[model samples]
Target: MKHQTSQLEFSRPLQVDRVPRLGSVEKLSAEPKELKALAKRMKLPALHALSAELRATPWRGGGLKVEGHLTADIEQVSVISLEAFRETVSLPVSRYFLPAGAVNDNDQEDDADPISNGWVDLGEVVAEILALDLDPYPRKPGEAFEEHVEIEAEPKPESPFAVLARRKGD
Candidate 1:
């Protein structure tokens, strides 16, 4: 299918409270320009493709569970070789999003990091996940650091005794 570019920003927000069904599914693919802009925002070398399939379900009384899968092809600069190379990023999105101030600060948990405010933007989440999953120091396949230290040969310093003997002979 011919992919059409979208005007939506990478952080496009979706109001979950406006959904018509309890089990709603949204499939989204980033336009090439959007992906390129997102990559630029993320400081990535390049972005070839980005797409996702997300599902929203009510959970834990008032909270919502946003789950999805993000697949992307990107290019990054290798920290070791200093060359650019392509990579594939695939991340499973699973997180419970609660309205801001719904939970007390003391009750927060690591795994249940909730979304702030009343909206959940799958686009922003996907971008964040992609950024997190990317290698901070990407290196090309089979690229390894090889340290090459050069040693310069120099004449050994003359001993004090040898200097003294030369002075006495003089």
Candidate 2:
């Protein structure tokens, strides 16, 4: 599909309290300019494509659970080669958000965050996940780090006088 470039920011706000009990599924794709903005925000060389399929389910009577898969096409400079190369990132998304001040069951909620102003910004969530998954030290496939090691110099031969002195002492 053709995407017209625009100056609009990337944003998708979902009201946590309005989530249906049966759950809702949504698919999101970033526009060219949105992608560019996100790339700059994340300090990436380039972001060619960004998309996600998310499902939001009401949970614990007041909390929301969001599950999805994220896919992105990005460019990064390889640490080994110092050249820009393309990479495709496909990762699962799972996040739970509880209403601010709401009680959450202790277990299985380690990843939970508090909903702000009754809403969750899905676009920012997508961008944050993408940023978290980027490789800190990118490298091309089949490339291995080879460290430069210096060779040790040979030790000088012991003096003949030293050996003679040792023999005399013996």
Candidate 3:
């Protein structure tokens, strides 16, 4: 269902049937138009570049394992400065794909899923990784965050339960 509702503007599906006995390697690079669409979908200020080198090998019971490394140049708005800044990110990628109805003993591998239409979208994998790796509150170096919130100097009143307990103790 995730693939059906996919808003991923960038996609490069690795065909399951094409993988050989040893393994297969693929290098994916995003085009300019794809980068623009992906940035919009991912809610980023800009995604300048995205590329990955992936290796696909056979796994347990007709499943497939894809491992790769991706590099991206991105622009984000700093949470403190609120100004756009650019950063280069490098990340290691790993994912498992099971054929539909195949059994998986490793329950902890919840991210594993069946291939969509006999293929795995490598671009989606990279995009998801980038999304997770992006800093939620990005700040440029030396841009310190100052807490504008002021704490109450006066002590708070005791709760009713605490007061009652104190009275009982007395």
Candidate 4:
């Protein structure tokens, strides 16, 4: 397949097959517009900056080893305070992207990540990584969380032994 970058503002598609035998390294940064769109897609308050430095090393068998770090400044609502706060997110990424169906049964491989159509969309991958790394229940600095415990109103029912005792007394 002839690999090509998409027209989207945040597109970071890499043509793995086109890389020279020596391998390739890439640095990607998202513009303000792209960050805004990403924030909207991820349901965050705001996304100030998004950048990554990635290295792609190809093996003789067409498998690629991808290593990178993604950094971003984002604004999100704190679950504890219910207020917006800015925080920096940094994630180190590493994965193996094998060519489709390249693994043999005896190889005992993990195919969680794979190259598709000779291309890898670094932007999408970074976004997903950031989302996965985010705190599902974020809390602001110094925000206290108080868990409310409900107490049942009814008293405990009498046990069989207690009923038998009452009958014997009567």
Cα RMSD (Å) per model? 7.0, 6.5, 5.7, 3.0
lDDT of 3: 0.84
Per-residue CA lDDT of model 2 for 60-114, tens digit only, reads: 7788888999999999989899989998989899988877787456646455888
Q: Which ten residues in a row have the lowest lDDT in candidate 1?
A: 1-10
Model 2, 132: alpha-carbon shift in Å? 0.8
Order of models, best TM-score first: 4, 3, 2, 1
User: Comparing candidate 2 with candidate 4, which one achieves the higher TM-score?
Assistant: 4
Tens-digit lDDT track of model 1 for 65-87 = 87989899999898887899998
Writing each residue's lDDT as its tens digit, candidate 4 over 1-170 gives 45566555477888778766777888989998999888888788999999999888886477777788999998989997799999998899886777767755566656446678888787777887887888878888788768888887899888999999999999
Clashes of each: 0, 0, 0, 0
Check candidate 4 and list the clashing pairs. Answer: none
lDDT of each: 0.77, 0.83, 0.84, 0.81
Best by lDDT: 3
| lDDT for position 81 in model 3 | 75
Tens digit of lDDT per residue, candidate 3, span 56-157? 897775778989899999998988878999989999999888887663566665568787767788888888888898888888867886778887789888
